[model samples]
Target: MTQPSEGPAATGVPTCYRHPDRETWIRCQRCDKPICPDCMRDAAVGFQCPDCVREASKGSRQNRALYGGERSADPRLTSYVLIGINALVWLAIAATGGTKSRLADLLALRANGLCSPGDGYLYDIERRVCESTGSTFLPAVDDGAWWQLVTSVFTHVEIWHVAMNMFALFIFGPALEGIIGRARFLAVYLVSGLASSVLVLFLSSQYGSTVGASGALFGLLGALLVAARKARLNSQWLMQNLAIGVVITVVGWRMISWQGHLGGFLGGVVAAALIAYAPKEHRPLVQWGGLALVTLVLLGLTALRVSTLA
Candidate 1:
């Protein structure tokens, strides 16, 4: 029997390798079985069987079942509350301090805001740069405060600044948390937030400040993008909504760092993708593939930045 192309071929007698009589219509790349499109899964750039997808989808539930700890916030409960706190912090800051720059300012940034020029010379202002050391790095032209990396995500400059961001996080956090578990979720959250800051830091080490949790939140969204695919859920709706958000953010807004958003998101998605979602007989090279790519990006960014300064 012939099979339809697993990917996209006009007309072919797709044959099922498993059942020779059955047309290998849709090929599952993982198991190499010919399944209908319904049973086909797009994963890591190839098609996988339904069983593979189901197994991948089970990681989150399995982890949750095995270990349930901490009464800290239900993750769901804290989702909205966390968002509220971020917004409130931003509002309080703005109300009292007036408009500030991005959240990175406290961590170790010294920029005025959102890649704002005139903050200071890149290396010239060590104090302005966000540092990995210390509690929150205060944005100064001389040296960056470090604690701010963690704290930056929580503070905002205005009321609406973090409000919408928190809303997005509140909505997406639970689904992501369910997939990765609290520990993994928080890890992604913090790590991605810092990753975003690192991206911003690479961009301009001057007096620019960053605020809001959108970068970290975007990381969750990024993870969900892959999770949705792995779980065999319809991603069209999500893809479109997120696309709109990207347009609004990248194309239509100022004071927004698409780099941070993209970097953090890539970090989170890659982090989630690192371990395996689908059942595999061996550790996937694709796991290392993402790491290599991110490392290259980070290294390239760091180099470009240094060269520019020099």
Candidate 2:
């Protein structure tokens, strides 16, 4: 018995939209376009051509999973906003001549110091040039500079410091935002930053102020580790980079604040744990509760430190 030939020319049937040389009886469910086996994609209802499938995907809603969530918001929106804020702050500082600028004095994080312009630290008031040690001589609790705990996260004394910290944030922020969503990620970043400042207030004896987003960026890394673990995702590379960062931080402890890094890392871990391990049924409430608890702890620490100063 002779088998019937399936060639397009032999059958004289409709050719595929993508490949005129191939004939197919199957058509896309949406567009009704003839498509070859290679162009066919399995859809919920029926087979679809590559073009129809792509178009459908663009219109379809994404589903939530066990690891992350529905991701209804733009994943990178938070990261871009954060980067923009940091960049704007850095540019403003640069325009004002950095440490000597009045803006810097107002924005920079001083744990327990209170120095202003013309207090002998502002050697060049007109040019906004001040001594690097200007922050060391200021009064702390006596002057009511408690807001430094929060403001410090946005302040950076020099170009290099801001650049380095922002670079780290740029690298890690988007990935984290994708994993935990905007609100949770923002909460982790801010709380960790505050935690870092609080640690500085307690641990450092010098009156010098510390500023930068290093603590917050480190907190993101810590959160990444925890979330990846909860999702059973491979985090070996993150671990390696974290170890390297720790070593670099230790070697440069003179220039960097170890206390800030430690506090931020711990805070990120705790915050992420609360978010990642939350029961699916009451995740939002549990996450909010965790955030509240963390905030209370940080506030308690800050109050305790201020009292000591008093």
Candidate 3:
């Protein structure tokens, strides 16, 4: 006659807690419960049960970037900041009034003079009136108001315009920022914006003034294309959407600044190239230097354009 021991028997092997039918000599290091091969998971020191592994996973730390590009604590910060700036500017514009307001005149980008109302009969700053009828008319770039090139990137004409551009930025900004990081993303944006404005100044007709973040938005699109390619991501959808945008722009080329879009796209491609190709060890320095070189080239082009006006 055999007597059942109160504790586990010392003769027979222990069965898995999960699987009573299977016998195993293994035990969970943390819980000391018998675990079979099916229930076993190798740990740093010893085997752990599925439940214990799951619990440990909860306690363990895992760091991942927002868009799966880099390890960042805050991935959406830059995108939200940009959106906030644009929204605040739009709100300020709404509070002051539309084109008629003096604030709008000051903030808006004019292709003429930089002064207040009635600066010139041909060009009025307050009114934003530019008369291309006379030879005395000079582009705003030649007026020593180079700040317009930068300011104009943030300005928008209509509500729909700002809304559309901001919506695009909202969708694309975070992902791009996560992949390229805040600094490089910002450089791509600003450099592309400046390039678009410069193109408008040089290539487009100077009869009217241009304003909007479309240039920068276009830059983001171009940069995304390049960055996605570098990361081996699927960009077919992006390419399709971009093709549609191009079609729309071409359809409304008369009303929209296609030149700005073209320039921004090109600039973004160049900036993304620099950022993507830089040496990993000196990425920050190389990226910054590349941005600076791009800026210098743009500035030189602007100088050449201004010289023509002079």
The best candidate in terms of TM-score: 2
Output candidate 3 Cα RMSD. 9.2
Best prediction by lDDT: 2
How high is each candidate's TM-score? Answer: 0.57, 0.72, 0.70
- TM-score result, candidate 1: 0.57
* Candidate 3 local Cα displacement, residue 264, angstroms: 0.8
- Name the lDDT of candidate 1: 0.60
TM-score computed on alpha carbons, candidate 2: 0.72
Residue 47, candidate 3: C-alpha displacement in angstroms: 17
- Residues 33-112 of candidate 2 have per-residue lDDT tens digits of 99878788999888999887777666454544233444536777787788788788888888988766667666666655
lDDT of 3: 0.76
Residue 59 displacement (Å), model 2: 15
lDDT of 1 by residue, 135-158 (tens): 233343222244554576676665
C-alpha lDDT values of all predictions: 0.60, 0.77, 0.76
Candidate 2: give the clashing pairs.
Answer: 112-140, 113-138, 114-138, 114-139
What global local distance difference test value does model 2 have? 0.77
